[model samples]
Target chain A: MEKIPSSEITPESVYLSRRRFVGSLGALAASALLPSGLRAADRFEELRKELTPLKSITSYNNFYEFSTQKEAVAGLSQGFRTSPWTVKVSGHVRNPATLDIDDLRKKFPQEERIYRLRCVEGWSMVIPWMGFPLASLLKIVEPTEKAKFVRFETLLDTKQMPGQGASWYSWPYVEGLRLDEAMNDLAILATGLYGNPLPPQNGAPIRLVVPWKYGFKSIKSIVKIELVGSMPISLWMRAAPNEYGFYANVNPAVDHPRWSQSSERRIGEFFRRKTLPFNGYSEQVAHLYAGMDLRRNY
Target chain B: MVWLKRAGLPILAHAGALTPLALLIWNFFHDQLTANPIQYITFRTGKTALVLLVLALACTPLNVLFGLKQAVALRKPFGLYAFLYAALHFVTFVGLDYQFDPELLKEAIFKKRYALVGFAAFLALLPLAVTSTRGWMRRLGKNWKRLHRLVYLAALLAVVHFVWLVKSDVREPLAYGAGVIVLLALRLKSVRRASAKLREKLVGKQGECRQVAVHEDLR
Candidate 1:
């Protein structure tokens, strides 16, 4: 693995030379470079402006599998076992295999991706995630032409996750993305954050990070990844179809029936800032829904 | 002892009602209000307001059912506390969250259904809070009861506001809805009549006990 000085990296340079950076740095240095206190955005100028504190990113979360209260999730999720895990990749893929978590780490080299996570509840956070691109994983699985959507599922154990016992939502939380969206470079299968293993409350072992959509769309603690011909029903969408749509892309123009999506309070800020279209990734993901009506879909 | 019972209990209730606010202040000063303090404060105050509103609504029913005269004395203080929290909740949204941006605040109230419902709930409680004093109560006379009845509507609107505000999970709001429904059901004419009958039976027993005590004292 090549060692590039952190001072040399800028947001523009990082974005322009992502593949080169990922290829050179490889697996060895990704974890070594990310000290817990170091802001992932410190080396990148654009991201530095809004990066949320590591404490907030780990502590303030909406992993309903633990609890609803943001502060309570950390303590409640302490019992979760993340190691000795395996993720099954099957369904409409040409290669169907259950790969151990350790094998996955060695298979794909880690890349550092800084992303803004916007919650549907009107708060946002900027996090530095360490992971490999979803496209890389999909390529390994060799998704067949019949696969229209990529479905993801979180582990379901009432003993491990106490919230699973509640009938408020269907257990074994699931999420999905269109095959095109899944193959997008922006979508990542993250393993760690702030240079360390994922804290249990923030989804441990492995998770998906879709930057352009609401935070809930980035399902956590993924146990299964299935390529399906039909669109998979997501946990939130199934529970409240009206509130949580399948393509929960962050669009300020498309207000939720109950609340305004026009602005969001940045986790550390006092006042709300105007929300951007596609969470400021409009140039990349907006074309995905070109002719489709966002308001109707939302 | 009589003075303490009459005055001290209400004072204690007032302190109890302010505990949420006190905790919020302490948390704010200690930097423990979490990352999104504005959102935290907004939710905290809104929840406290709703809880106090429900507690205030329960007071009249308690008086009607078991004839707890002390519960009647608590109604004004609880309602006022609810109003105080509701006002704080609104102020947090307008002053802190919106930073007093008129355009944003207008859009929130006019365009957002949850904010509109929340604003309406607060407005409904405003007149009731203002008329809580003995002077206004006497001046309004018969109209005061009719006006104060708006609390039920306010409570319903507040619950709706909460239910709509949540992105997906409705369990918390639904629980509040059930509580409000049960409280509202107790106010029905038939339920009131049944409660009156039960109240008479209990009051009759109390009267018999008082009479026996008087006879023993005379002997």
Candidate 2:
């Protein structure tokens, strides 16, 4: 109610289908023929990289909020209601408020960015997401000097999400990034992917995308964003601290206690590929962890 | 018709045993093996192996609780299929998942407790699978039965492997563990006698239910 970003129109037209993503490849090629379109196509250099087939991308998801079984999530989440959403930004902010989901895109124009998403389970996917920078949103809320970290929370509606009743995991999934890490340009709060508004299984309406970290770091169906002074204990960290660390940067050298992190199978490929440090975003974000020991932090 | 009755259960067992593998192949071909094919294959094979192992363990209990002495005959085939699936699970991990990279394999076998226990379970089944033939049974005599008891160890290890790998939401694995524990509990002499007493009354005239559990060519 405090930091309202003006009024909102109904959410933009969302083409929530696999065809748009599958068709984008051809569209990119044809658009190259036009001078103006070529610049736009070239802007998304990462798009040319092998996009995980839209079918696999949608069907194979790790939204445990819907189901633990990856394939079942798509089917189980088919009836999830995502419209008429609000995100409350509070804690350690000068102007704490709840903003309409549509106003986010209206305030910060959405951009198309293709990123590689790696899961802690040692599987990977390359996805094209439509969203704006978290830094822009963070600036709007205006964090105070006491704020050292940003904690994100997913919605906790048991009637809507069946997996929420999975008592072993403390519900209302939570994840956090350091103040500096939250401000990084690579972090984006995504609303949609592959020219379509996100399907329920892929976290419809809104989600976070921190490309460098494990997929769990990108909490989905977010309802709350709170800035705090101390490092927040994530669900995984609280569940198995020995395995899942707060700074879960994709470090191949540090193996998960349960499985090998040294290599990962790209979803579509037959063979496993060597995992990159910081998921190949080391060049851009490595300096943030410059002096810290990653192995211990991991 | 008499031959059909004699052969019916074996035929049914064969169909039931091979179906999971066939479905796995069908799914693999149809692009229904989910996003992570290797993982899908791994879980399918591992689950099939564990389930079949439990089924094989169930055969004796079936005979013990009922007068169907023929149930003991299924123990061998079910166990052999369990071994087959366990081997496939191992190959999927070592070959497809890791591409037989020795360094990674070494690291995993040492670092991951689940891998180590799973490998031990496979090793436990190896001797039972090998000595399953009549030739080896004739060769070892009483020793053969002693060696074959390692299957109980294999079943226990496989369940532990499952429990460890699944970090949380352990209801599935724990259920399997409880099953193995109950089956193993059925092996106790006192429990077996009590069950046999109950079975004798239930089975009435078919009093061939004397021996609660006997290793009949159990490989």
Candidate 3:
């Protein structure tokens, strides 16, 4: 496993203290100190992208579990319960167990990773996600050699997620990645955002964050993680096979049948910027698809 | 009641037609249009175009099925409104969204299938809009009706463009598709003939009234 740089890891106490200091400064003073566009954390300066405002990140989302309308999801997700959540890790594993959210948090040390989220819908956002690498959790479960793919499932409570009642998509949205991709150092099971618990609309409790793939592959509000021999079918692929494929890597060369993928609009910006292949994580993730044709897979 | 029918109804229709654009402008000023204001504006304008197009198509059928002669007068205004919204939708995409980048716009029109369909629909509406005036109607004479029939094709293409553009949850587009189909079905020759026959049977000796109604509407 690749080691995270010690300089990048801010102690939890320091993080809390900084938040208090920033909050005490209030909105007007903070705006005076930092320019509007330079809102991202100092640690993420290496990425050269601004963090999408927390308002935009929480408000404008594609969690179809709440509603198809991007603006409606945040409001509709207000009733959802994240605490007392338990995640079931099973299938093709030596030690399959149902772990409580608290247990999962205590067992692994969390790290804040700033990653660019490129949506399949031609929009992008940089998010400061706080979570541990998914590999640590998979190690605890002890996946057997037969585990070729890792499948994820979201919560299915229709009362909480009203869009599940509609036939737009099948219930309990499912997503999957190859076992190797799941085990990658960049892959994270995010628990929080902006140093706070994950917002309900942004997939509260826990969510997957595979930065290289389009945002949908990072399925939200996860309840199940399973390892299987054969490739697992995902919801988007089942809904529209031609438009959304299994790999769903952010590729500028390959366009979605309906829209262009060559460029994407950053959330707060008026103009679009050229999209990056594998969402600019090409060095880390491009090797995974070597020898295979991405266009065919897409 | 007579004044209301003669003048008030058309005024109401015009106001109704402009409400979406007005509401969008209001939302823009208030900062209530969501995170991506451009997307909100584009979608609202596109939806307004489709809705007005459907309403314009419905005008002829309103007179055919019912004896609403005043509804035929609404066709021109609604058709023009539809064209205005479609033009706005196109301008927003090419100007605001693409920022007049010819290469990007060209790629969108040529390479993207949905864009091609949507642009085709807009192009089909253009000439009809230009010739909508009374002078052009008089100059074209018999050819005017033939030219106006192109609205049906434009409506079909517009609905298909919407259906193709959506990622999933196509219920909204499907409903619009159903509306277009229903309007087209109502205008079919066989359906018109059956309706005429039914009108003739109902009015027996006063059948000239039905012919006059058909001439004014089906034209």
**DockQ: which candidate is best?**
2
Off by over 4 Å in 1: A1-45, B167-169, B201-219
lDDT of 3 by residue, A165-199 (tens): 97857778999999999988789999999999899
TM-score on alpha carbons, each prediction: 0.86, 0.89, 0.89
Better of 1 and 2 by TM-score: 2
Q: Indicate the residue-level lDDT of B110 in model 3.
A: 80
Residue A97 of model 2: what lDDT? Answer: 89
The list of candidate 2 runs beyond 4 A from truth reads A1-44, B199-209, B212-219
Each candidate's iRMS in angstroms?
2.0, 1.0, 1.4
Go through the candidates in order and give each one's C-alpha lDDT: 0.85, 0.87, 0.88
> Candidate 2's residue-wise lDDT over A3-50, tens digit each?
655454323443333445635654555444555324433434645477
lDDT by residue for model 1 (A184-298), tens:
7788999999888888998999999998999999999999999999989998988888778999999888867765688888888766889999898775577788899888886
DockQ, 0 to 1 scale, candidate 2: 0.71
TM-score of 2: 0.89
Chain A TM-score for candidate 2 is: 0.85
Docking quality tier of model 2: medium
What tens digits encode model 2's per-residue C-alpha lDDT throughout B58-162?
A: 998787655477788898999999999999999999999999999889988899889999999999999999999999989999998899899999999999999
Model 1 lDDT per residue over B144-170, tens place? 888988999999999999998875578
